[model samples]
Target: MDKHLIDDIKHVSLSLFNKNFFGVYHGSISARVSASGFIINSKDTILDEVTEESLVRLDCQKRDYRWSMANADVHIHEHIYET
Candidate 1:
């Protein structure tokens, strides 16, 4: 994972925490790692516990780590990649 993206996730997750948007294990966050790929929170993992290493890498064409993103709003990321 890129340091910048890890930082972004930290900031976004902290912001969500501040807004009471996530509880102990409630929400997930993800970001595009590249034009054809993304790194998303692992399935069932809590937002507060997310770390750079825990973010699973996924390639749209490969679908290798698709299950890792089962808990996230993957369609949004897919749309972003599509556009």
Candidate 2:
């Protein structure tokens, strides 16, 4: 993830946490990197305190992740990849 974007996520996470919009470890953030790829915050890391290195790279076609797997809708990513 880009440094600025990661910083933004941290700020947003802190805001959301302060507002009680999501529990400490109940929420996550994701951003599209390309049609077939994206970077998602790690599964166990608290969003508010997540760092750039804590981000995980996911490839829709390969169903692979650098850190951990997520149960998100694979079809959505596939559709984007196809498009």
Candidate 3:
């Protein structure tokens, strides 16, 4: 994982948190990490307080038990990143 990428996400999370957006909804935040892979917040992550463990890296649409920690919105993020 890239340190700068994680920092960028954390920065955005704080900015968005003040807007009462993500902080209120507790929604997932994501960033594309590769052509077919992206990192997103885990299902229960607090956006404003994201840590490395709070992020989940997904490279495929297929889900396994390992993906249980991924966000429920992972598919939505994947679709957006696809294009």
Q: What Cα-based lDDT does every candidate model obtain? A: 0.72, 0.65, 0.82
Query: How would you encode candidate 2's per-residue C-alpha lDDT over 1-83 as one tens digit per residue?
Result: 67887787788878888888757667766667777677666666675687776667777666544534542433444455453
Off by over 4 Å in 1: 65-72
- How much lDDT does candidate 2 score? 0.65
- Local accuracy of candidate 1 as per-residue lDDT tens digits, 1-83: 68888888978887897799977667777777777887777766667666776677777767654655555676666666653
How many clashes in each structure?
Answer: 0, 0, 0
Instruction: Report the CA-based lDDT of candidate 3 relative to the real structure.
Output: 0.82
The candidate with the higher TM-score, 1 or 2, is 1
* Model 3 CA deviation exceeding 4 Å by range: none
TM-score of 2: 0.71
Question: Which structure is stronger by lDDT: 1 or 2?
Answer: 1
| Candidate 2 collision pairs | none
- 14 in model 1: Cα distance from truth in Å? 1.6
lDDT of 3 by residue, 1-83 (tens): 89999999988988888887886437889998888788899988877788888898887655666478888887788789874
Ranking by lDDT: 3, 1, 2
